[model samples]
Target: MDNVRTDKWLWAARFFKTRSLATDAVDTGRVKLDGDRIKPARAVKVGDKLAIDNGSDAWEVVVLGISDKRGAAPVARALYEETEASIVKRENDSQARKIYREPASTIKGRPTKRDRRQLGKAGE
Candidate 1:
């Protein structure tokens, strides 16, 4: 196909795990076409530029191929070409995360009463 719906393309390209998730991302403005927020049904063609933020990572890519079918990772990867800047930024962000992680992320589930007491004492 010469063009495909943005959400379908995102799902086929493996940017999101499911088409529903891709649609949600587009609806929430986390997916943009040529820097403009676009509806999930918007059509995407080859050479179209897309900016996508899928929670854990952001991508700036140029469409290289179009397909509505979800395929293997290698095939999905061929659908779009990520910008060099996006790759470098993602690597830097990954390194920074490795060096310094959010302290709250270490907490497992709900804190126990004893843990709460310790936190209270620490606050004081």
Candidate 2:
């Protein structure tokens, strides 16, 4: 009988920085409740499963606690339990899908020993 709104809980649990952001994410089809679309004010209780797609990755977590007010990160950490699969997939997607720029290899073409010796005399 002591449940909170889905979006509000998401924000309280630190899934999103703000309640409005959580509501927007839910309204935009990025957040789901037990495989169904949910409104921002939908009541949520313990054990309810939520599937959220955060652009590059998706997550599935089971509700463990509920609150309407945002709290500290340490307190927020107790609100849900992210599935092992979600953690693995998210980490893999984050590592594999990222684009990295190596500063040492920024310039095009190969740098010869003479070029290496001069460091920046390529236009000569």
Candidate 3:
């Protein structure tokens, strides 16, 4: 197809797990088309620029093809091509996050007794 709905393309490209999620993301301004915020129903054609922010990582890509149907990862990848600068920026951000990750955020599950005691002591 020459064009596809923004949400459909996002889902087809594997950016979001489901079409509903893609639509919600668009509604919430997490996705943009050609530098302007757009609705999920907006039509996207080949060569259109998109900026997508999914909290953790942001992507800047150019639509290389349009598909309304979700497909395999490799096929989905072919739907869009990320800019060189975007790739470099994402990688740098990832590396910075790894080097500066918060120690407290790394703790998973419930806190141990000692950890609770330490937290209590810090609060006092």
Candidate 4:
């Protein structure tokens, strides 16, 4: 295809797990085209630059191919080319995350009865 819908391209490129998520990201301005915020229905053509922040990771890529179908990871990867700066930034972010993790990430669900008792004792 010469071009595809932004949301479909994002899904086909494996940027998002689902087309709905891609549409949501575009609507929320987490995805941009050529530095401008665009609608999910916007057309993505070859050579178009896109900046996407999909919660955990951000990416800047140049469109290389267009497809509306979700495919294997290798196939999806061929749809876009990540920029060098984006790769470097993602790697640095990964390193930082490895060095320091969020304190709350260690906590799971609700505390057990024993844990609650210990917390109550500490408060006294």
Give the CA lDDT, 0 to 100, for residue 70 in model 4: 96
Clash tally for model 3:
0
What would the TM-score be for candidate 3 when compared with the true structure?
0.84
Q: What is the C-alpha RMSD of each candidate to the true structure, in Å?
A: 2.2, 8.1, 2.9, 3.6
- Residues 5-123, candidate 1: write the lDDT tens digits: 99999999999999999999999999988888999988899999999999999999999999999999999999999999999999999999999886456669998887778777866
lDDT score, candidate 2: 0.82
Specify the poorest-scoring 10-residue window by lDDT in model 4.
Answer: 102-111
Candidate 4 local lDDT, 1-43, one digit each (tens): 6768999999989889999999999999999988889999988
Instruction: Identify the leading candidate in terms of lDDT.
Output: 1
Clash pairs detected, candidate 1: none
Model 2 TM: 0.74
In candidate 1, which residue ranges exceed 4 Å CA deviation?
108-124
> In model 4, which regions exceed 4 Å deviation?
109-124
Cα misplacement distance, residue 72 of candidate 3 (Å)? 0.9
Tell me the TM-score of model 4. 0.86
On TM-score, the stronger of 2 and 4 is: 4
- Top candidate on TM-score is 1
Question: On residues 40-111, what C-alpha lDDT tens digit does candidate 3 reach at each position?
Answer: 888998989999987678999999999999888999999999999899999999999889875457458888
The candidate, 2 or 3, that scores higher on TM-score is: 3
